[model samples]
Target chain A: MRILGIDPGLTRCGVGVVDAEGRAVRLVAVDVLRSAADEPLEQRLHRIASGVEAAIVEHRPDAVALERVFAQHNVRSVMGVAQISGLVLRAAAANGIAVELHTPSEVKAAVTGYGQADKRQVGAMVQRILALESVPKPADAADALAIAICHAWSARSAAPTAALTPAQRAWQAAERASRR
Target chain B: MRILGIDPGLTRCGVGVVDAEGRAVRLVAVDVLRSAADEPLEQRLHRIASGVEAAIVEHRPDAVALERVFAQHNVRSVMGVAQISGLVLRAAAANGIAVELHTPSEVKAAVTGYGQADKRQVGAMVQRILALESVPKPADAADALAIAICHAWSARSAAPTAALTPAQRAWQAAERASRR
Candidate 1:
């Protein structure tokens, strides 16, 4: 399955694409879309929407994984998140693609095996799991990849090749070796 | 000047268009777009976006008046408002139309002369100002008109003909006559 994950925001939105089968995952693309805070709200939204739409058209992922927004301490940020999520959801729908929303905790748990994993932990695991040389920069970028991995794992949990593939085992061994 | 006002919501979105000069305001069209709550979020947003885009295309309004979202007691509702507002803003930007956001208090005060006025008072004032036989049904619809009227009055505040037009005076008299 090919999945595109989005960590939606007004100032900076992160998008990552991954191709996965069974217990194996491979990174396709990852980047952050940024908009200026001083710009008019409509213009900012338009820019973000254009970037997201372009990714969807170019990647043609089977599904979009978005972070589900919940109440947070910062009311303003919460509103921004919801707004961007809405734009992404609409863009995916326009392309006749399905969207799956995963909560922050769910993404963390899926990637790092801990619901309350800190940003660094999640970032490290994503780097190892995708076999990237280094963790994706800007927490938002790693978060997006985490979301995609979460969706991919859940979707393929019942596959016959449930055992860790050679690439997955290699990463797991590397993590263990690094710890020693 | 012509203005298209939107009262953004997920389930029921109110849209109203008006043409105004000086203190005289005339309703062009008013209606509420409804989407089933059971529908997927993406589908619901797409439906609302399409409706708002259609209104903009048909009316060719000079500007769009949108209700500015703020923190509300209901978190879910607040999120919904922001989501819908974002969608509407994007649609306006796509068509090169400008959008002006008014707070609920601003809309009420513009029509009723009191920021703290109740919904009924605002509705009554809107009906009188537009010379309508009765207030528009569903508070959302009336609220949409109120927002447009607010924008119109603010935009024309510096016009040389700021004095009440003949139509405005007639409506003022009707409001006074109805009171007696």
Candidate 2:
């Protein structure tokens, strides 16, 4: 299974792609799309939308996952984030890709086994999970990877993968039962 | 000058077009585009964007006017409104049309001479301003027209009209001095 994760933002949106083989997931690509604050709001949104569309086209993921927005402290930033998220959702829908949203806590729980994990913990866990030499920069990129991993693991832990060998499947079921 | 007014909403977006001849503004068209809440977010946004784009193409407006989102009590509604606003703004930019924002209070004041006017009063004023026999059904349509008139009046009342005839120009200058 292939997945694309988007950490939607106006100035710096993060996008990460991952491929999952049963319980194992590998990061395929990751990057941040930036728009200058000084740019016109419409143009900034357009650039973000274009960048996300391009990423989806290049990666051709089976599903696109994004961070679900909840109550926000900053009204201005929240508005921008929601707008970018809407654009990404629309782009994925246009391309006939299924879309999903996971909250920040959900991603943290999936990656670090702690819903209340801090930023550093999430970045560290993302690197460890992807087996990368260094943590992805700007926090946004790392968050994107975490989102991707969350989706990959969520699917693995939620269902029995036909792709997995019989031994691997039994082990996965046993692991799931043990966790429960 | 032709102006397109957008009352941004996720479920029901209102669009109104007007032609401005000096200080006189005439309504060209008005309609509401509806999207079901049960529908996917991307489809809702796409429907609104497509409706606005179709209006622009049919009317060939010189500028687009949208309601500026301010602090709102309902966070969910605000997010949807902001997302729709972003989509409309991007559509206008893509078509090379200038876009402007009018706050709710500004629109009400422009139409009804009261910043704190109620919806009924605003609706009545919109009908009177446009010389319509009846108020436009669905408050959204009336509000859309109000926004368009606000933009037209704001531009005319704030700036000198170089296109005005000599007499009209002199009258405008005298009016400005009187306000001062």
Candidate 3:
């Protein structure tokens, strides 16, 4: 399964795509879409929307995972996050993609095995899990990859073992062997 | 000038259009676009976006006036408003129509000469100002009309007095005379 994860913001939106088979996952793409802070709100929204649309078209992920916004966060930035998330949700829907929202703690726990993990811990776990040469840059990109990993892991667990395809079963066995 | 005002919400979005020549204002259209609460978020957003887009195309308003959302408002409902407002802002930008956001107090003050006017007072003032036979139904619809009126009055005031067209001046004089 392929998933696109988004860390939505008005000034900078993080997008990451990952492909997973059984317990193994690999990064397909990761980048941040940036817009100038000084730009008009409409133009900023349009820029972010277009970027997200382009990513969806380019990656063709089966599902999208977005970080849920909490109003209790920095009041100003939270609004921007919510607004950008709206556009992202709309774009995903237009393309017939299923979307799931994950809270920050959920993502942290999924990626680092600890809900209280800080950015550094999450980044370290993401790099180790994906076996990347280095952690993704600018924090946002790494956070997006973590979100994808979260969805990918949860999605795998959600599937019934009996429903696993032959290839998935084989991959799972190989993963188990490697862990030994 | 014709202005389209939107009270953005996920379940029911209020839209109102009005034409204004100086201080004389008349309602052009008013409506409440609704979506089922049980509908998915993306579908709800799409429904509202389509409705606003269609309104813009049909009315060809010179500007859009949207109620500004406050984070301090109902926490759950505020997110919906912000999300819907994002979509509305993008639609207006795509259509090349300028959008201005007015606070609730501003709308009340513009319509009823009191910033703290209640809904009933605002609706009554809307009916009186527009010379309508009855107040527009649904508080959302009336609120929308009040927002448009707010924008119309502010836009007129923002324009330098010397820039007023002959027709606008004549309408202003006639409105003043009729008031006498």
Candidate 4:
């Protein structure tokens, strides 16, 4: 299974793609989508939507793993992140890709075997797990790779989409059929 | 000028279109976009994006007046509002339509002449300004109309998207060029 992970942001979005076979996870691609800080919110969002769609089309990942935005101290920043996350999710849904969101703590726990793992530890763990010589940078890319790894590891325990949400279910069913 | 006002929400988004000539404001349309509460977050967002885009295409409003969600007491609900607002803002920007955000108090002050005016007062003022026999039902529709009215009244003083962000200015310039 291939997983596309996104660490959603307005100024800098981190995306990583990985291929997981059983317990072996291998990295495919990792990049950051950046928009100028001075750009209008709409243009930023538009760029993010396009960038994520392009990534999805190029990688053709069976599922997208996204970092869910929780309430941050900075409302403006969190709002931007949530907006980008929603936009990416919509793009994935439109393209018939299943999307699963993981929290920061969840990702850290899944990746580093500790819920409160710091950035460097998470980065080191990612590098070790993916067998990369160096961690993906600048931090956001590593986070995306960690998110992809988390989803690949935890896919069976996540809440699968129900009947009404056809796009996600379609991807899920297709994956199941391919497995069969 | 015709204004498309949106009260952003995942479950029930209220949309209003109004035509303004000087101080005279007339209601062009009002409706609510509702998504099932149980729908997946991605599908709900996608549906809202489609609904807002359809409204923009059909109404052809001169500008979109969206409510700026503040740090609400409820984080989850506010996050949803922010996400939907971002989605609609992107849609409007894609259509080369200008967007202006108004706070709840600002809308109340502009429409009802009282910043702290209650919902009933705002609804009454909307009916009075639009010459309608009764307030728009479901209250959210009235809130949306009030927002459109607010933008109609305050466009000259609001930020106006000039000197704010380059993308908006660029879109503005392109629009002027196309008109010429």
TM-score quality measure for candidate 1: 0.87
Q: Runs in model 3 with CA error above 4 Å?
A: A156-162, A166-180, B155-162, B167-180
RMSD of 2: 7.7
Share of true Cα-Cα contacts across chains kept by each model: 0.81, 0.52, 0.55, 0.62
DockQ of 3: 0.54
lDDT of 4 by residue, A53-128 (tens): 8998898888899998887568779889988988888888777778999999999999999999999999999999
Q: Over the stretch A20-57, how does candidate 3's per-residue lDDT look in tens digits? A: 76568899999999999998898888888888899988
Off by over 4 Å in 1: A155-180, B155-180
Among the numbered candidates, top TM-score falls to 3
Query: Lowest lDDT 10-mer window, candidate 2 chain B?
Result: B155-164
Report the C-alpha lDDT of model 2 over B62-133, residue by residue, as the tens digit.
779999986455888987888888888888877777788888998988888899999899889888888899
Q: How many clashes show up in model 4?
A: 0
Model 2 ranges with Cα > 4 A deviation: A155-180, B156-180
TM-score of chain B of each: 0.86, 0.87, 0.88, 0.87
lDDT of 3 at B155: 48
lDDT of 2 by residue, A1-180 (tens): 678999999999999998876557898999999999999898898888888899988987877899997646687788888888888877877777778889999999999999999989999998988899999998999999899889887853324465678898778657644542
- Worst 10-residue lDDT window, candidate 1 chain A: A155-164
Query: What lDDT score goes with residue B130 in model 4?
Result: 96
Note the residue pairs that clash in candidate 1: none
lDDT tens digits, residue span A1-180, model 1: 578999999898999999887668999999999999999999999889889999998998878999999865588888888888999998988888878899889999999999999999999999999999999999999999999999888744315235778787677547644543
- DockQ of all predictions against the true structure, Cα-based: 0.57, 0.45, 0.54, 0.57
Q: On a 0 to 100 scale, what is the lDDT of residue A111 in model 1? A: 94
